[model samples]
Target: MEKFTTLTGVAAPLPIVNVDTDMIIPKQFLKTIKRTGLGTSLFYEQRYHEDGSENPDFVLNQPAYRDAKILVAGDNFGCGSSREHAPWALKDFGITCVISTSFADIFYNNCFKNGILPIIVSAEELEKLLDDASRGANATLTVDLERQEIKGPDGGTIRFDIDPFRKHCLINGLDDIGLTMQKAEAIAGFEGRMGEARPWV
Candidate 1:
C-alpha cells in the first residue's frame, strides 16, 4: 500500500446513486488476484458498450477525466457486496480517493485497506464538489488528510472526520500485514522461545 498524505489531482464526477461493488469492476473481472491490470476493467459495464468499445458518454471515457485520481460520486456509493476487488479496481484506475455523501460500510473500510481514501461529507458539500468535478480534467481538488479538509476549485474548503487509527495507518502506509510486521522481532523471539521450550514434543 502507498502512503496517502496529501493529494491534488483531477476529480471525476459520477452522480449515480447505489453504485455497488459489482458495477465497480463487474464479477467477470474478479478472476485475477493480481491488482495492476484491473484498472483497465474498472467500471467495465458502464464505461464500455456491449461491443467492448468505450462509451464516450461515460465520465471516465472523456479525455479530461481519463487520468482523474479523485472521484466525486453520489450517495450510497459502493453499496453492494463486500469484495475487496472493488477498491483494487478503483485504486488501479488511478483513483486515490472517493468523495461522496455516504458509502456502504464494508466498501468504505475496504477502501482504507487498499490505500484509497473514502471521504464522507454532507450532501450540500458534495453537491459543490460534484459541480467542481463537472469541469472534467480541470477538476483538480486538494485533499489534506492531516487537516481533514477538501479544497474545491472555487476556493471552498470542506472539513471531514476520520478515525485517528485509520488516519495513522494511511499516513504511514501500513496495511494489516504491515502492521503485523512492525512486531517482527517479537514474533521471531516468540517462535524461538516456543521451539526451545517444546523441543521433540
Candidate 2:
C-alpha cells in the first residue's frame, strides 16, 4: 500500500447514498485479485450505460471530476457487502480520501488497509464539502493525514478523527504484512531459538 500523508486534489461530488461494493466494482469485475486494473471498471454500472457507452450524468465521467482524488458523498456510504476490492478500485481511480456523513464499519476499516482515508463527519459538514466539490474544475480539497484535517475549496477546515494506530500505519505505508515485517528480526530470532531447542524434532 502507498503511504497517504497529505493529498490535495479535485474532489468528486457523489450525493447518492448506499454506494455498495458491488456498485463500485460490480460482480463481473471481481474475477481478478489484482487491484491495478479495477479503476477502469469502478462504478461500472453507473459510469456506463446499457450499451456500454459512458454516462454523462455520473460525477466521475465529468471532465472536472475525472481525476478527482477525493470523493464527497452522501450519508451511509459504502453500505453493503464486505469486499476489499471497493477501496482498491477507488484508489486505482485516483481517490485518496472519501468524506461522508457516515460509512459502513467494514468498508471504513478496509479503506485504511488499502491506503484510502474514509472520513466521517456531520451531515452539514458533508454538505458543505459536497457543494465545494460541485465547483467544477475548481473543486479541489486538501487532506492532511498528520493533522487529520480537511480543507475545502472555500478555505474552510474540518477536523476528523481516526485511530492513532491506523493513522501511523497510513503515514508510514504499513499494511498488515508491512506491520509484521517491522518485527522481522525478532521473528527470525525467535524461530532460530525454537529450531535450536527442538533440533531432534
Candidate 3:
C-alpha cells in the first residue's frame, strides 16, 4: 500500500446515499483478484450505460472530476458487502481520501488497509464540503493526515477524528502484511527456536 500523508487535489462531489460496494465496482468486475485494472470499472453501473458507453451524467465521467483525488459523498457511504476491492478501485481511480457524513464500519476499515482515507464529518460539515465540491474544476481540497485537518479552497478548515493506530499505519505505508513484516527478526528467531526444540516432532 502507498503511504498517505498529505494530499491536495480536486474533490468530486457524490451526493448520493447508501453507495454500496456493488455500486462501486459492480459484481461483474469481481472476477479478478488483481487490484490494478479495477479503476476502469469503478462505479461501472452508474458510470457507464448498458451499451457500455460512458454516462455523461455521472460525476466521475465529467471532465472536471475525471482526475479527482478526493471524494465528498453523502451519508451512509460504502454501506454493503465487505469487499476489499471497493477501496482498491477507489485508490486505483486516484481517490486518496473520501469525506462523508457517515460510512459503513467494514468499508471504513477497508479504506485504510488499501491506502485510502475515509473521513467522517458532521452533517453540517458535509454540507460545507459539498458546497466546496460544487466548484467544478476548482473543487480542490487539502487533506493533512498529520494535522488531521481538511482545508477547503476558500480557506475554511475542518477537523476530523481518526484512530491513532490507523493513522500511524497509513503514514508509514504499513498494510497488514507490512505491519507483520516489521517484526521479521522476532518471527524468524521464534521459528528457528521452535525447529531446534522440537526437531523430532
Strongest candidate by lDDT? 3
* Candidate-wise lDDT, in order: 0.93, 0.91, 0.94
Colliding residue pairs in candidate 2: none
lDDT agreement of model 3 with the native: 0.94
Q: Indicate whether candidate 1 or candidate 3 has the larger TM-score.
A: 3
Q: How would you encode candidate 2's per-residue C-alpha lDDT over 15-57 as one tens digit per residue?
A: 9898888888888887889989999999999999999999999
The CA lDDT at 35 in model 3 is 81
> In every candidate, how many clashes are there?
0, 0, 0
Off by over 4 Å in 1: none
For all the candidates, what are their Cα RMSDs to the real structure?
0.9, 1.0, 0.8
Q: TM-score for each prediction?
A: 0.97, 0.97, 0.98
Which lDDT tens digits does candidate 3 get at residues 1-201? 788899999999999999999999888788889989999999998898999999999999999999999999989999999998999999999998999989999999999988999999999999999999999999999999999999999999999999999999999999999999999999999999999999986
Q: What overall lDDT, based on C-alpha atoms, would model 2 receive against the true structure?
A: 0.91
Question: Model 3: how far is 10 from its true place, Å?
Answer: 0.5
Worst 10 residues of 3 by lDDT: 26-35
Candidate 3 ranges beyond 4 A from true positions:
none
Q: lDDT at 122 for candidate 2?
A: 94
